[model samples]
Target: MSVRMLSRFRAITHYMKLPDDYEDSQGLQFRKEDLNQREVNQIFGGAHLPAPMANKLLRILHGRRVAGTLNDPNLQVNTAQFSASDQRKALAYLRANIPVDEVINAGLRAEDELKLLEREEDGEQKPVETSPQDLPPDTATNEIPIPTGRLPRRRESDSPYGVSPLDRIRAHNIAKREAEEKRLEEERKKREEEEALGNIGTLQTQQEKPKKLSPMMQKMVERATSDLKEPPEMKAWERLLPQAIMTVLIFAGCAAYAIVYTPPKRSERLWPDIPPAAATCLALVGINLTVWVSWRLPPLWALLNRYFIVVAATPRPFQLIGAIFSHQNFSHAMLNMVGLWFFGTRLHDEIGRGNFLAIYFASGALGFMSSLARLVLTDGLIYTTLGASGAVYGVIAAFFWLHRYDEFKLLGYPPDPMSGPQGLAFIGLILGLHILPLFSKKAHNIDIPSHLGGILAGVVGADLVKKHMDERARVRAERLKTMGTLEGVVQVKEKGPEKAPQTAAGR
Candidate 1:
């Protein structure tokens, strides 16, 4: 026999001896001597028979021959004769060796194959024998028959325990290879399913093949994908660069304008003549001393500083500034100081010392100006005002503008006093507290015009501060967005190869 045929024959022989219950068989179904030349030729004719097919054929021969059918040339192969166990084993055997399409084409029934294998393995085949004359005409050559008992035993060296070690190794390797292929196929299918589900649009992958990404391109794609999922955080450079640039530009522009433009002849100093804080303290001290002296001496303040009181008769222009500092009694000074303390600290912190002082004095000046205007327009009357009520009202208005969204409540009557209609109600409530005194039998002096002027100044100041801060925040937000977008673009460019592969895949 050729080497290929010899290998195939050896494989069959090896499988036949694999079952350990060979001794329990009732007897041989057909001895090797029963196979005529024609049957032997049929068994060996197929070249490169897979090991599984060869094993199945061997089992079939043993089964038919032992059933006393060795001489019948006209008997058709009856697949139903194989039991359920035999069919399953046969089909499994075929599946391992061939593609699923070929296994189906081969018409191997797993159920029936398994049954035959099981029955034959149980040593259930009955013995059957025939003389040479009983064989078909072509197979009945009158040669002397060899008895079943005379069959040759496999040599100990030919196989270890009647099975070749080399065949076991080959079978093991084939099984491992098939298992690996199955695993890879399963993984490929799972990946496709996941990709299909992830896509929002119609899946277009049926006709398109995926092009593998090159290493550099793959890294780019990975980075871009990550960026798309999670926005990159703002780095220190991103946060500070715009602010620095803007600040530099502002300073440079201011310096250029200052250099280019000359001012008109000075009417007064640009800054306050005295530091605002120091000026305010001295004014308060002077007022307190005046009150003390007036109470003790009685006639000193009335004669010398009568013009300090803001009234139509003694209304000196300078008294607008001076009257702000003076007080008729301690109670008047104390009340104005309380208002200053409440609004001054916060305005100073928010706008800086320079801006705070500017707002304080500017609001106070505007307040008194409004009062002066009102006094000039009114009919002849004596309306004396000697407190910082108008300037304090300006501070309160600034607080309202800055904290418009803040909640305010009053007397537990209406909640959210600063919102919608409730805000209007609160305004009316405040106006009633201040204005109703004008009609009272003995009304205390209240500077309504100064309060109105202060409110206007405070609103303008708060808006300016808010506008400046908001612009800074807006610029920072824009810078962050631009940096993130640019970073994505840079990463993509660095991974140029990745885009090419993805483009190819899309195509």
Candidate 2:
């Protein structure tokens, strides 16, 4: 038999508490005593059993046995009378069967053998009789007498079995169920008590009213609230600096042109009849120059709306793009240009030049569309509005979208506690400020709808480009994987199997 089978057989015999003489059909006796350290090691190819198992097996072998049983076949008959050489041979066999350490450590002596025999004799001793009264009350009564009745008296707690086995089981089950229910009830009460305490604390806090703001604090709050309104006019130079520089440069260019190529006398127009492309180019230069001069010269703002204005008599699609480069005042142009410079440079770097231009133009177009839609919905006369505010607002939207996690402080707000989401919230608040006036008893002249339209356009454009790039990358990865698989298949086919030669006779 295999060593594993032998070990399993020994374990089964030990567990079943079978007699040593018990034999199978093959007459192979499983003597418990034979499952010693040496024999156990041999069964497992001399591998070391864990110390606990080895110790357990040792205890089992040493334990008392049934009386009058024959000597176990595993025990050597002349072990007690063995010579030195015989003992050495036996020890060697034992070591070879079991782990060397187990064989060396195992000290089986004549005294232990005699003790086993004595234990066996003691285990076989007959038990003395005891009185029923000496036992515990529960175990004392082996049976109960039934009362005489035509139908067995139906006791309250008894079933047909007289002892009411069902009643006992039912009582135990009911007790367990009641205990579980009680535990759940206790937990529920504890949670309710905690919640009640919390609510009481909150109520008490509310009852104790907060102190009113101090007179000084009240005054400060009033000042803060008033500060939100439009501020007083700036200095004369601060207002006209932007327009002054722009006017000087414009007249200088016009004068230079006139000097270089004087126009025919009696020309009806003071301005040259420039081509459409040159006109557009001149318009851009004028807009940029106006913005720059506005930053340096503030007084020229008064005449900007009258002199530098170009009104679109009929609303055209390109007017949206054109409007962004148009200005009503030096202040407006300067402010718009400042916004663009601050946000546009970084945005251009992030999305690249092509994408930036697309986003800017598309957002401005959307803003114009919003304005046109508003005009149609209101049935109001189409009014000319000009500024780079819509396009600049688009750049701001793109900035927020790309760097949503970047933090910045709102003007006149607490500094250290600021965050990106909070700054965006402030922007939303300002937009609401513009929108709320529409419902009030005031002229809602500002083009609030166009700003919102531009912001929405910018957000959508950036997201679309991002998603497109991601999809392109994913497609490229899938193509590479396919190519690799194809290459591997081709290589396998290229290295075809070599053929065996056939004999001449077979051929």
Candidate 3:
């Protein structure tokens, strides 16, 4: 036969559940002593099984006998001695079935063993009858009357001495239930007496007038009542005024310092000649840096980092612009500020405040997007890039376009101080910094592509601004010519003749 067919046959035959009439079967008739002896023999014989395993098998066999006897109390068969072969068969059957529910089977086994032991002890201490010679003459002549209703009968498997444990357990439960019922009944009677007293007390309270409050309490009650009146609701502006004032003060302070306070290079001057728009932008950067300092607190840092840093892995479009205003440390903030002061003032002078601001944001955005795209392609999600380096590079590009970078040294390096190659060399130097970290383990974080992206954006933006300046100027001049007082309405005729439409309504 095939292995599969053999397994199926074993599963059908040996795997059957305990028989329904197992209580009447001779297999479940073994005494506790016999089962224990067999278990000890198995362990001592150096059987190739764990001690606990043999013990568990014995317990399961005992439990099976107890579980079977649940319905048939009178079932009995001689089981004082078991053969080695029968013990082996019983152990195999237990191993197959008992593991299905070890806890429950073990419990049943223990309970049955305890009961059998108690029964055996009681049987051994059976009551002895006195002889006629030993008894008193009067006691010997008297006879004890037996109950007529029933006679005590012993089952084949019952103990030879005291009453069965099942009968004793039933009696104990009946006594306990009676005690609990009595306690509940007494409580009910006490509750009835209390309820009667409560009714009398309530009636007396209804007949009596309420006691007056003390003088001090009356005054306190009046004050409390008076204080409970609703206060007048605040206007929207009144409610928001403090927050608005604080915000304005913060921005105003930063702006005043940026405009009036001369930069380090022009420290000798009383005030720097910074334009209003550029000053405002610098002030906003200052506010962003102030918030950045509070980032030492983990929760705030996480919030700011997510909103401000250009996270290449989890890129958010808004962060592209916000990141240009963010700085990691004080040194980082100072370096960006120096860059801005050097190039920003010059760019503002050349293209006007509005155009400068537009180019600055556009270039920074393009630079962040470039870095984000490259990181995504490289699968560098954990990589992060921040600071205004992209915008600073954009300013540098604009400065180079308008003047010359030959005289200026970028980060203390200028290969050619007065040549066209200087600009290209400076760009190349920056790119080298970005690439150095990849090759050398000692080098720090550098985002070379962002600088290049900004420079390219700056060039394109500058060209566009220059091209549109004339058209923008002409439109501004026309708006000024049509300016009028708000109190007086002014109408103007079209310079060109109006053309009639070739439609049915015109006809």
RMSDs, each prediction? 40.0, 34.1, 27.2
TM-score against truth, every candidate: 0.33, 0.34, 0.36
Compared with the true structure, what per-residue lDDT tens digits does model 3 show for residues 42-68?
Answer: 544645444444454454344444343
Per-residue accuracy of model 1 over 1-507 as CA lDDT, tens digit each: 556433222211222222322211122222222344444344445333444444544444343332323233433233334444544554454335322332221122232235446755887652232333334455467464322211122232444466477865675466446555766898688778767776322444633546777887676455433122332344434433443354334334433442344323334534356544444445545564565455444334443254455654335555656665556677767777777766666665565444454455556656766665565456323456666766666666676667666555546535553334333344345557766775778844577777777667666766765776588689999999999999999998999987898999999
Which parts of model 2 are misplaced by more than 4 Å?
Answer: 1-287, 290-313, 405-427, 476-507
Please report, as a residue range, the 10-residue window in candidate 1 with the lowest summed lDDT.
146-155
**Candidate No. with top lDDT:** 3
Rank order (by TM-score, best first): 3, 2, 1
191-235 per-residue lDDT for model 2 (tens digits) = 677567663334545545555887866664454332323323444
Give model 3's TM-score versus the native structure.
0.36
